[model samples]
Target: MIKNKISRGVLLGILSISVDGIAGLAIFPVLLYYQPKELAGLWILLTSFSALLNLAQAGLGPVITRMATEIKIDSTDSDIEKYYLKVNYCYRIVVFLVFCICALLYLFYIRDVLIKSNYLSSGIIVWAIMTLGYCLKIYATKNINTVNGYGELGWDKLIQIVVTVFSNIAYVIGLYFGLSLIFLATIFFIFSLVYLYGSKVILRIFVKMPKILSRKKINFSEVLDIFKQSLKVLILNLVSVIVLNVDILIVERFWGLNVIPLYSALVKIVTLIIAVSLLIQQMIYPYISLSWNTGVYKKARDLYLKGLMISLITSIVLSALLFLTAPILIPIWIGYGNYLGAKVFGPLLLFGIVYTHFHSHVSPILATGKKTYITPAITNGILSIILGLLGAKYFGINGIALGNIIASLIPTIYVVISTLRFFKTHSKYGGLANGEYKR
Candidate 1:
């Protein structure tokens, strides 16, 4: 069973990567063809904002993965339905709240800034449409995560590939039609709805009997337990969001919109590599919860190490490829304006990617529950931001990349090592509840 799951996970993960890669490569070309250079930056900015907004729902998926794994392991079908509805209720509430928050922010503040900066031609319309779509996407995201927790990584990735391929096709159509950002945003929203339903059909058919996270019972205590763990995992996510994305935001604001297209093209491609790096951990994430629950720490640890080794080696090879071709690739792919800076941006960002990718594997192990990983993550995230801001202030785009790389290594070699070691130590002793955890 383990071998089957792992094999299926790899197969589906590769398919997901290929389709997503095609989509990622396809979008930039279409965007470049349709929009001006500055607007490309706006595209990058809005996408990054969408990613940031996703942080609002950060803890929801992992919590689902953890809870669903527990219920599945115990063969507790009764608990499953109740847990599903209860958490689904909370998820809907979260979606609404995030929707309102983004709506209000755009209404009062960001809309004007975008117009003043001339990034958004439709201003509030674009903001409103995209914000709502992002929220829906955020909401739909849990379905994929929930299925993942059931130890169905292959099925989860299949669902993910479907949504991704369809959405990017929708995006490409919008570009070909010469739609404004507003129309594209509308297309995004429509696709979100499609996948929202599409995920249901996939989960129902593909998942084994008794889907747990879609429950009717509102188990408040259990719900709160999930929430608390999610909250901590959310913090750990900060480390990731910052390291992968913060540079684009920094460049967008400080260096002005024009420079962003240059920097962001490289960032976008590299972000794909980072996403590939993350696939290893994400594929095994549910197993961390499952094996931990089953008291199969040795199995979990061994699988995790194997995944980590694969990701690390993959990232290193990809980084070398980026160095050779990114300079040449950027101008060819996006067309050159001020994008010459990519020559410097690629190598430094790849340096950060290595550590960041290594840490991605480490994080899922620590983040299966609770806030154990939060402080160090929060500390490193903050430090990265500080250095990023200071670097952007003094050194421009290159410095910001440098800031993230430097701060990324700090936690990779030092802070997180001790945590993993301790966790391993305790796992051998008995189980988590019986283990002594020092804050």
Candidate 2:
């Protein structure tokens, strides 16, 4: 039965990932063929800037996942209901807070910057709509946690597949019709609707929170505990954005917006690696959390090692394929005789992604509720920014990519070694959790 469930989860994960890749391939041509160079650069910057709103979620989704897994493992009907309510409440509050912050950013900084650049001819309206899109995206993340906690990867991935397909179809149709950025941004609102629907599906099939129990008052203390755990996650999130997504803004600041299209293309394409490599870890995340929380540490370790090995193999093969075909495939996909930055950009960005995911084993560690264990990741990311800047100062774009790759190596090795050692000592000492363990 367990193996059957795992196999089903893996199948669903692959389905969802194929949807993402197809969406990527579908949209790239639309973006390149339909949009001008300047507008395309602004679009990239807008998407990158949107990542900031993600930092504001306060790590609620991850904590909810952890809590949800614990609830599922403890296996009581009432327990699931209680967790669902708490997660719903937290998701609402955090998303509301993030939307407020985005409103202020638009009024004070973003609107004027875009205006000065004279980018996005549709003007502030498109920017406003895009900002709303970011908010919607963040709100939608709650569905992922809710389903994951229930150990329903099939439902989870199925929902993602629908959402990705709809959003990509929307983007392609909008761009082909020469619609404005506002219309494109409207796609996010559509995805949010899909997510809300998915949440309802999860509730009906998995959570089944009773109407009588639903009347219970919100627990502020429980919310506070989640917030405290998520504070570290928030900082780590912000640092990651600073490290990974801030480059286009920096390039725009120093060099100008003209070069942004090429850089954005490189980054987006390289991320295809992560999109595929993470499927196994993400599919098994809730199980790992449940197993570890229930003191089945050996099973958790096995799952983690297995996921990491598979991830490594997936990444290497993709990287090799990237090197082999990028030169030929990229030109055909994005058009010819444009974007001089593509040549060396592809390989370096591939290496950067490899280093970033090098410590895939860390996922299980994070699941164990050691939120502070992310300090090394956060630290490495910040240092990567510094190194990337220095490299940009000396060797330009390729240099920055190399710096990011270099910065990640030490942290990856450190996390792998520390995590293994910690696992050994933990098993030997037989430390207790929630008063559950073996001799």
Candidate 3:
């Protein structure tokens, strides 16, 4: 039954992300209506801040999913209860600490930017509240993925759709009533609280609060090991943020901030394609982790190939559609008067989409064990910075997209070749029989 549920869960994930994309699309109207010149600055700040928050997440998402899969396979309900409790507690604490540190940093370092931009001071306060609420939401959402339960995913998606609707309603109200940015931020925080409360309700159905709270002492050594193991992924994650968002930042520095809304609009469309790739990756991760944990390397290899095929087909079709229709669709969506076609940016984005699909889908395969993590992290970081800078100089907006494509391409090639070579060498030596091979 659980095996049958994975397909449904994957579909739910796609729908969930699509809801988020719709919300993103809806926000463009507000950006275009008010303060178009400052749109890029806002995007830069939002992305940079969000990236910092994610850094604190520290790759625990996959770890939690792996742990959950292992618990489910063991089929010991009691063990599952204990494991969930310990993990959830640790996850919450980390999230809270991360929010606090980030809020403090923003208060001290980035306050002037906020003030000068005419954003209300209350916006900062609301951001802190939203961050705390999201921490809870993230933990609850991960539990659904770990247990292969799509009910929570479906529920989350429904709530997101509602939130998006409410946000748009609030945007209209703000514009009609002349509300300040602080009020908009407050509305956002209120919506976050609604989602967090919903998450708690869903979480209670599968796990009691007491059971989800850690009673066993969490050792610093164990935490450190987790941090160490996840550090490479964390670094890889940071590099990814830079590669993806740094273009807007560079553009802001060189060009005026007004160019950002145009750039942001283009990037958001590309990100929708990426969201689908990420959904496939998320679904594949638990399966890969389970297969690897059981030493079924062949099964893992087959799964990766299957994901790759799916990714290729979907990416090509979507990329082609976006490239061909961008001239018409973007203008209709954002109004032709305000939008400009970044023609070269579209093709470069196609490459980046393919590169991102492969990288996201294959990362878990490459990160299966401690020994394999370094290659991806190192290669992604080095290439991201080098190509990012070069792309900024050589191609401007398109160059940034090209740099991201190149950055993702290198590690993907390495992982694919290495995995296939390992499989081949193992098959030749009869190591395939036991699923044991020298890497």
Count clashing pairs, candidate 1: 7
lDDT of 1 by residue, 323-397 (tens): 777667767777765455654566565654655554665555653453255666776788789998998898766
Judging by lDDT, tell me the better candidate of 1 and 3: 1
Ranking by TM-score: 2, 1, 3
Q: Order the candidate numbers by lDDT, best to worst.
A: 2, 1, 3
Compared with the true structure, what per-residue lDDT tens digits does model 2 show for residues 161-244?
888888888888889899977887778666867776775777568764556656788789987888988886676666667666
Total backbone clashes of candidate 3, pairs 3 or more residues apart or in separate chains: 0
Computed on alpha carbons, the lDDT of every model, listed in order, comes to 0.70, 0.71, 0.62
- Per-prediction TM-score, please? 0.89, 0.90, 0.84
Question: What's the residue-level lDDT of 213 in candidate 3?
Answer: 46
lDDT of 1: 0.70
**Per-residue error at 290 for model 3, in Å?**
2.2
Clashing pairs in 3: none
Q: What value does the lDDT take at residue 369 in candidate 3?
A: 53
